[model samples]
Target: MLSILKDFLLNLFFILIPIFIVPIWIEEKNIPKHIKRHLLTVCFALVIILCMTIPVDADREFISDLRQIPLWLGSLYKGAATSMFLCLVTIGYRSLFGGTGFFVTVIISLFIMVIGIALEKKFLALSSKHRVLLATALCTFSGILSIVLAQTFHRIPLSSDISLAYLSVQPICMLITCSLKEMIYKNIALRKRIIRAEKMEAVSHLAASISHEIRNPLTAARGFMQLLEQHHLSPEKRKQYVRIAIEELDRAEAIITDYLTFAKPAPESIEKLNVKTEIERVIDLLRPLANMNSVEVKTTLAPFTIIGEREKFRQCLLNIMKNAIEAMPNGGVLQIYVSIEKQHVLIRITDTGIGMTKEQIERLGEPYFTTKGIKGTGLGMMVVYRIIESMNGTIHIKSEIHKGTEVSIYLPLSSNLHDLTNEEKKLFMAL
Candidate 1:
């Protein structure tokens, strides 16, 4: 019995290595849940086949023959059943009770596994996690039950066959369980992120509306004040009043412009354009600013075309580059790289400027979130984020304090213009 147990553990270990390790190491980024499930099933199936085919010798023929069956197979089935049950239970519990208790979940998992075994068919109704837990409970129960039956009967009627059946259910259950758990967690996280984004967008729109209404009158008032300053009045009084009016008008205008940029961003008129050409134009526009700060701008542009609003995209790139330039007022390298991967274009902007802390980066897309004092309104990156999102693109930022920052943008290849009604196109153009 000791030798059998040792062999069973060793076999189980070997079986799991392929199922877990290969997927993680070889296809790290895109490990599909279905592939994982099938892998578990195949691994356990092999173990069962081996057990039935292998020979064993001992005093108790039935026990010895049963020992020859692969333990991993039982483990797989139990795990799969338990996982499926757990998923179903979690969904129902979350809906009805708003949560699930750990112990209650386990109990439900065990019940589902047993039912699946008795039915001898994979229950597709339950989720992967519940299936896994059920499979685990079923296999464990079967193994213990087998031993009890043998001791009571004083013989093994079909110990080997029963053990093989148990083995088949466990591992599959475990695999399904793990997959379900991951899926659930991911979905929850995604939903939370989306909600936060929508809230930020709403705030930005409000800000923009207020800015627009305020700015029109402010512009007219400033023009009238300038006309008054030009009149032949006393030199000292004219200079002082003109200074106050001009300064206040400039300040008010700045506030309104920043607010509008954040709130009511214009939609992009997306077109297929060369990314390199766009970058060059922005570079020319920002060169004087970079020169003023004594910063060196470097670019390695790959020829890639993307369907996007050219002006809005330029503004996004300009905002990021301007931030980089400001960070290194003493001078540093602003490196830009444009590349293409399968079905997507990648833009990476790196700065050798003072980088931000983790906390700062985490709050980057939030409205009015800024590290630059007085001069910064904190809406530059927010605007950039809105533009990128509207284009159906993704952005990732990595930064280490004092080391520097890298921002990567991934845009899909589909440049096909979204179909728009004439009114919609006109509205978009006006914006």
Candidate 2:
């Protein structure tokens, strides 16, 4: 019994090593998640096959080797397709060996896959103590039965005491694995959350500093520009100078507004705003700039109602649309679409422009990060992100290097922002 327990611990440790080894090969956010998923699945399968070659000997009979760990984990986390592949591999590997318990291996392997798929969600929700016990119980029964069937049908010699050792050791091994997995993952999650909180704190501080440091000078410059407009010389020259001054001042004001907005929390102003009307107004405001850049602006705006401040919504649309228009230096089509979905309003903006890389997209809402070098203050999109978040809405931006960019925003059709239940709020935030 002592020897069997020791082997069980050793077997499970080796099985888990391949799983934990994935962190070294694939860092979070470094590779696309789907690719990482596939790679990890392959790695876990390889480890399982390797473990299958080394079985625990009980009175010179097979008892345990942690064969079920990969099968069960792959199903629970990697989903059906990967789990099915693992099942096939396990069956094939056992058949290739073809010593004894072949039929029992195939039957129990099939049972594991079936149970894994059926109980994945319920099992995940279980407490660690219960989850480990339940899973371990199933694996233990199948393992002991495999030994029994081997002795009965395949004429392999086995002892009853060895089966008892399998029963005793399997649950202990599973409990240890479960505890370690939960602890490691929880620590990782906590670390990520702490990093995120720190980043947000830094953003708030920077926004405050920028707003206070630059706003007054920008206001003074704008006022001087307004005074100069009164004592004009030539119509064309005055117009050009005034235009340049005002444009520069407006740029300064935009930067100031972006930071100020970030530093402050949004006020509670909930009203039923017409999405189509507000969007049309923004399009009109940007028509001249769009025309100047030779970029065509077209919209398929459906009448949709959402709870938000009208000016805030207008400002949000203006910043986003302006960014879209500017993306097309050589001019391209900027398309806007608004539609009503189940309980929300959907606004999608697509621009045929230079587009952005994956890294640029990931860095979109950072305080000082900018895709456009000198021309961008990086706050336009930052303000856009804040507005959407405060409105209890969500935004998704997809871009390719040269193909183009598409941004989709979803806002719930509620009486007020506070009306959103926790679940609905999560839905929008997840969007």
Candidate 3:
């Protein structure tokens, strides 16, 4: 009795462990479906063979083992093809034992295979609780059939203790294993759904950000082209308009390329950026727009070094200064100043324009909330907020209606000064 119970428990572990653990590996998208299916079939076949190799009682002419559990599970959960293969394996293995019970094993396996194949569709369609009940019922029926056939066909004597134990334990083990498999399947399906939803959300955000960024340069280019259409414009002015238009188009292309870097497999390169050089580049690009709005550009820039992506840094500066110029349609002073404050680089951009209300300022970075109304998507400041945060920086805006607005950005100073040449270090010190 002790030995039979030990064998039964060992058999139970074989079926249950893999059912719980293998789903995690097989659920990965990288594994092809046919490969996953083959892997599962091989796993269950091994479990079936292990149960058969160690029979419950080596002395009995008619051996009993819990091999049918995995066979039935594979069939009901998978389909008829797996059922046919498992039935063949069970019969073939039992034939090697050379006993009257081998024929009985053949009959029972075939009967269960037929039943499993027939009811597989309904078994899968059932709820988890119902599936467990049905599987347990089927296992119990197979146990009863084995006992009746053994007695009627060959009058083989059976131990009452072993029979009772098999009847009770087989159904219970089937119930436990089936319930666990159903639970794992439910969780895996839910996880896949959540991952898909998160991917969709990321794509939506990227689309909105790219559209907003590209529109800025395109809008500026359109403005320059409009200026060039004036028939009475001087030759020099037309040439200047065409140059600014070409530069704006190039800026638009660069913005598209920058956004695409997020999709690449490799990490983007980060470098030490000179604040003065990048800021001046942005100012030079936006100079045409500033002149159109009659806004005077004044800068007090220093060559402070910071760590970030250079294009993103330039995009941030361009967005802020463009907004400042647009704020003052009737002409005003756009002042940009850079200095060191504590352990950070401070960039202050103040505009003498129609400033914003406290309410407007609070809503600055909210998506699609704009004082420019139809002309703005409100994503520019949103991008600014994201980039600054990614660089471990902070931005503060102080504005009052009819007064002026001051935008202050604080970025941590790059600490790798050893990379700079002596001349560069001297230039930094002089500034």
Candidate 2 vs 3: which has more lDDT: 3
Cα lDDT listed for each candidate: 0.61, 0.75, 0.83
Q: What is candidate 1's lDDT per residue for 86-187, written digit by digit as tens?
A: 334333432332222223323433544445455444533456566556545555565555444444444444445544443443344434434543455456
Error of 2 at 249 (Å): 4.8
Candidate ordering by TM-score (highest first)? 3, 2, 1
- Give the best candidate by lDDT: 3
lDDT of 2: 0.75
| Model 1 CA lDDT for position 4 | 54
Model 3 regions lying over 4 Å from their true place: 154-159, 260-431
Superposed Cα deviation of residue 251, candidate 2 (Å) = 10
Model 2 CA deviation exceeding 4 Å by range: 1-6, 58-64, 125-130, 154-161, 222-431
Best by TM-score: 3
| lDDT for each residue of candidate 2 in 1-431, tens digit (9 for 90 to 100) | 67766766677877678556665446664778788888878877886777677766622223346777777667765677777888898889877766555667677778878877887678878876676677667766766666677677666556555566666666666666666666666666788799999989896778575775466557766765666667545677667767776776777777777777765587457688878789999999999999999999888876556888887789899988998998898999999997645677899999998899989999998776787786778777888899999899999999987778999999988644366556545544555
- How good is model 2 by TM-score? 0.50
Per-residue lDDT of 1-431 in model 3, one digit per residue for the tens?
Answer: 78778889999999987898788877765678898887888888888888889767543457778888998898888789898888888888888886777877899889878988898798889888998898889898998888888777667456677777788888888988988988898899999899999889977976877787789889999999998879999999999999989988987775565454434433257899989999999999999999999999999988888999888788789889989999999999999999877658899999999999999999887555668875664567866776787788999999988878999999998865566557546655665
